[model samples]
Target: MTAEPRTHRTAPVVAGLLTALVGFTSSYAVVLAGLRAVGASPEQAASGLLVVCLTQALGMLWLTARHRLPLTLAWSTPGAALLAGTGMVDGGWPAAVGAFCLVGALILGTAAWPRLGALIAAIPVPIAQAMLAGVLVSLCLEPVRAFAAHPLLVGPVVLTWLVLLRLAPRWAVPAAFAVALVVLGASAARDGGVTGALLPQLAWTTPELTWASALGIALPLFVVTMASQNVPGVAVMASYGYRVPWRETMVVTGLGTAAGAPAGGHAINLAAITAALAASPDAHPDPRRRWVAAHTAGWAYLVLALLSAALTALVSSGPDGVVETVAGLALLATLGSSLAAAAGPADGRESAVVTFVVAASGVTFLGIGAAFWALAAGLAVRWALSFRRRGTPSADAASGGAERDAEPETDAAAVPDAEPEPQTSTR
Candidate 1:
């Protein structure tokens, strides 16, 4: 007999908390790094981070409530890095925000147009995989660097993570984090120096709009976020059997961006890898049930962002060596699998290579980075080959043979059976 399906009735508060913690912890470093690269003051960057996190949490909550799916939203970490790096060269924060608005409009437009959406969907899977792999590479590298800096702090954390992965893969990340936290607290107590290391304090920054900033920063930021972040994010949902409306999701993301941009929130998109962690069968085979977890994360994000100062202080107080190392090791398996999947199959190998090289190359043109270029190049090659093959005739047709070369071999195997057996004498 088939087992009865389980129905989920968990509170949204839990789901929100889970969503927020997962989103913030996973991407906070990258966001702060971007802010520093772009020359934002520490206070401005901190305020911006809070704004982005809060907006993203609200957006995810709103969308998930409406769809009843475990849809998680996130700020574009890579896109932010690109903005921080390139925006400084182009114009500044104003340009970046303008570019973001433009990109949002484009994403909304694409969602509105079925044809455009289909075109975006037609991007080769290998290229997408390659891009994802490239992004995960840095995550995998972090643990090694952290360990190198403080073996005493990071070593035990890594060891604990390995033990957890061996025995309980499902709880590996959280378990590793918990272990690191314990070690850090013990170390802090032993050292007896708790003067400056405290909870983060509240900070806020108003948005500054400018034409040069829009062209230099916002446009590139938008391109990278949509191409590198949102595209793969949508794929993650589809792969996991979520039937969310792409257009509505994009519109919501746009709304989130508009709400938070002035406050230093960069582009926000759907979560790709992080969502996979919480939505996978490991979390719960039942799709409906995982919404509880996602909703929990969202609520958590709201609380954390509101208490930005406290959260920031806590993170600052932690031993970076332990936290960074643990985070890196925790994500290694995911990173490896993503890279392997992206490079799969000989037929799409070239596309995958192009995607990886372009994304990692750090090349930019027309205020667009390599992610879009890689996709465009791979698609062009794929289509050209298909068009070329369409002009060629089959061997059987060219030979004018009466028998069809395309016929199945099984037809020949059954020839003798085509004739019926003679009737029995008893008849």
Candidate 2:
């Protein structure tokens, strides 16, 4: 019998820090951009960052503890992208805040209503995985793209990651993070030493509700966050063989968003790529112990939230693509696994390919992102193929029918036919 492996104390700690680092460094700038797009001042944007991080951190802790799963909550990155694209709405930042609140309420409703939750859960495994792979493909390409763009900056980081992967696979991502920090620090030192107060700030803006804002911002924000962020997040967990509590997760994230909206924060939902980092086997060999990594990551996010002001400045001062490269490297393993899961099933191969292509293409239709359409296209293809196959008669069936019909003798003793055995399907 194989012996149980002893748990390593450092594994969970490293996973947690990596998760926190990836969460902040990878997308905080986009969040700041989104806030500004809606007319939030620099201080307001900083407060929004703090609020979103703190709120999501609490949600992560509560959800993971209650469910005993490695669930990570994050502000909706796609939703933020949507905001950045839309620019200032009719009623300005206050109106955007209102939209944020409305989106939270809608998300909460999905959790409260069984039918909605069931619909989300009922998404077929292959289709969900395909959608996730599509969502992640572009981001996953960034490491190599970053290296090609800035060899001097990203070369050492990528080399460090590769070296760690060969010698100590578990530490590969963390080593990359370290190398990035060193590179960024060196760059900053050459120009001037970084300076910022590591203090949390609170800037509250009362929401101003308007029908125009609701249609222009709230509805679209909710749609993108759910389709591009939350759904794929669920898919990520499922890809890793985790049965996430979808309804509870939605409700918790919705509540967190509602709590943060007044402070200029937008939507918070289940994380896709970063959550995979904490939940992966790399965090711990035993799946049961992986939750410790996510829980620790949640607490780490809280710590970062307290220092959001300084953290924001530090990230802003760092060179472009540094954070993206690190984030991409961190998720390389996840991207591989997700792609494998999405394409592994022969029956779903075409559908999954369609989903992956559309998602990675980043096309938008009628204000909706490509992710939702990719899922729809994949499901349609799956259904169409299944229908065609079921209707078409098999060669064995045709031959068996012809043979039986050709027999002249009707008596059972004259000639007996062997019945076909049942086939058991396997993945």
Candidate 3:
């Protein structure tokens, strides 16, 4: 009889492990790629992997324990992609670190100021989606490049990912990584052996603030993270009928980001897709037990953190394009979704196209990368087009009308999900 209860308890625990496994395997390669693109050495990238895992794991545990809700956090995969797109800045790694610190500060500022959050929400979704799609285009093409450059090494990985995507979409990325692991092992044997420190170690670099990094890296990273991860995370949790304490949650994540920045972590925010994995009915029959799933997932990420160094070492010693192939495959779905989302609201669709082309062009001017320029150009075109439309003003004036209409709903404490399900979120 007691054994039955134990088995019931095990359900959420198992689900939690699956959540962590999927979450980690799905995107850690992208994280490493982002760090390296931003000028991190192999050791620094290893530190980054370890620190992001630690901060997110600890953040999840604290939030779940405190609120008794399945509130989970993740390193910003979109932000990492932005880093990869931005590449090495004028000041190199230190500048990137400074930009990370700035993103954390911006997140904290949003929590302290409601207007800030509202402003972020006000940005047209299509522009953000376009920018993300553009950034991903270059990375998503890695497989094509790899297949052409080293067909033998890249072919099996693509085949594995394609087969699993048809059979079990969720496991597709992880399966691709598994096949790549075999490829890497063979490459290592041919090269004699793997190389890199197996033990986890911290590599700290004092952050150096520069105007180029600030405008190019910080602002874009912050916007992508907010639009893709934090906003969608709130919506996902609300879909489960949980009124996430938005301000408090932001504060925790913001603080965690700042704490991890020096050690090479970019940023951390609420988990969107993975949130559903733990918060849904699939996690447990009783809603209260759902928090246990998040808590268990936290421990799972902690375990993964221990392996970060060794994984980093293997990736460093592995053949070129093999790891990039894995990262690119991992991001393909995200790219497709972002592209689809970018093709919306016919009025500004052209603006989104302009944004996409500019960003994908990989053009940089005055040390500012294409992402910032893409948004600027998109907004410019959008305004120019809107001027001619001469439509009546807007359905609602601004926050004043919104507040008046939502007052009653606010009194009822019904969670309002103002954001759509993000197609751009990696995890």
Candidate 4:
């Protein structure tokens, strides 16, 4: 048995703090950029940043405590990236707020109607894992890229993590974070000691409904969010061997998104990369106790929200790749496991590789991110490879064709975030 007393004590808290730190520091800029791109004023963009931190903090708190699972919620980074690329719409920031509201309603709608989440769940396990590995490639590369760019700054942080990995495993990530903070702090001290508003000012807009805004903003926001954040989040957690309550998760996150929209927050959904930080074995040896990490991450986020104004300034002014390097280090373990799983069983390994390649390539089509297309491509490939003559029975130890057709169920359930439906036919 992994010793109970020592293992659970500080590891989860460290994991939690690390989760909040990386999740916010890495993406708050993108969130601000997205809000600004859609015509939010400076104050409005700050409000967006402030509210997303607070709202998603609450969702993570509620979900982790209620279900006792290592579930984390985050602002939709991909959706925010989409926003950054999109120009101002007809109703301006208010119209963008209207779109945010629509995205929330659509999330709640997904909760009520299970079809969408179900279809996602039906995707095979190797394929889901492949998508996750693909998604992580860009993030996992940051450390190497950071060190190459600024070896003087990022090198020490990575060295600290590596030394600790052999000497003391659980604390490696937290130590790296601590080192990065020093690097960031030293950089800030040189440049006038981190000056920005400690108090965040809120700017609220009364949302306006417009057809142009709906088409230009709302639909696309909703689509990219579900495809990139929610679905992949479920897959990520399931890879760690957890079943998220689909409807309940939607209800909590949807409520958070709706509540924060008026205050300038965009979509909030399940965390993908940071979820690995909290749920991975490094958090704790016992899977059951790992929720402590997620719960701690929730409280850490609340604390971060109070400090968001200060942190926003610090992070914005700090070294470019230091924080990202820490984040990449944290995800290294996850990337290793995912890569191994992506190779999968012999039958589906080729399709899984296709999925991983597309997801890692980071291509976009029809305003949707690579993840959606990666999954689609994998499924298509699997179908083509599995196709057989209608009347011919496959060569197998099992006698009947019934057994061969039922195999995907066993395969998909390897990650149980979504359960597969039993097959039924009437002749």
Best candidate, TM-score-wise?
A: 3
Relative to the unseen true structure, what is the C-alpha lDDT of residue 259 in candidate 2, on a scale of 0 to 100? 87
Top-lDDT structure, candidate number? 3
lDDT of 2 by residue, 102-157 (tens): 98898887766544433443455556556666656665676788888889999998
Per-candidate TM-scores read: 0.66, 0.64, 0.91, 0.65
Global CA lDDT computed for model 3: 0.83
Ranking by TM-score: 3, 1, 4, 2
On residues 146-262, what C-alpha lDDT tens digit does candidate 1 reach at each position? 888888877777787678778986556666666666776676667673324234433434445455455445544554565456655756776777755666777788777776665
Residue 364 error, candidate 1, Å: 6.2
lDDT of each: 0.58, 0.71, 0.83, 0.74
Candidate 3 — which residues are off by over 4 angstroms? 1-4, 391-427
- The lowest-lDDT stretch of 10 consecutive residues in candidate 4 is 418-427
Where does the lowest 10-residue lDDT sum fall in candidate 3?
Answer: 410-419
Candidate 2 residues lying further than 4 Å off, grouped into runs, are 1-49, 60-103, 192-198, 202-250, 261-300, 395-427
Per-model RMSD to reference = 12.1, 11.0, 5.3, 7.3
Please, what's the RMSD in Å of model 4? Answer: 7.3
**Model 4 compared with the native: what TM-score?**
0.65
Span of ten consecutive residues with least summed lDDT in model 2: 418-427
**Candidate 4, overall lDDT?**
0.74
Which residue runs of candidate 1 sit more than 4 Å off their true CA positions? 1-41, 64-89, 92-103, 178-242, 271-297, 314-327, 330-334, 363-427
How high a TM-score does candidate 2 get? 0.64
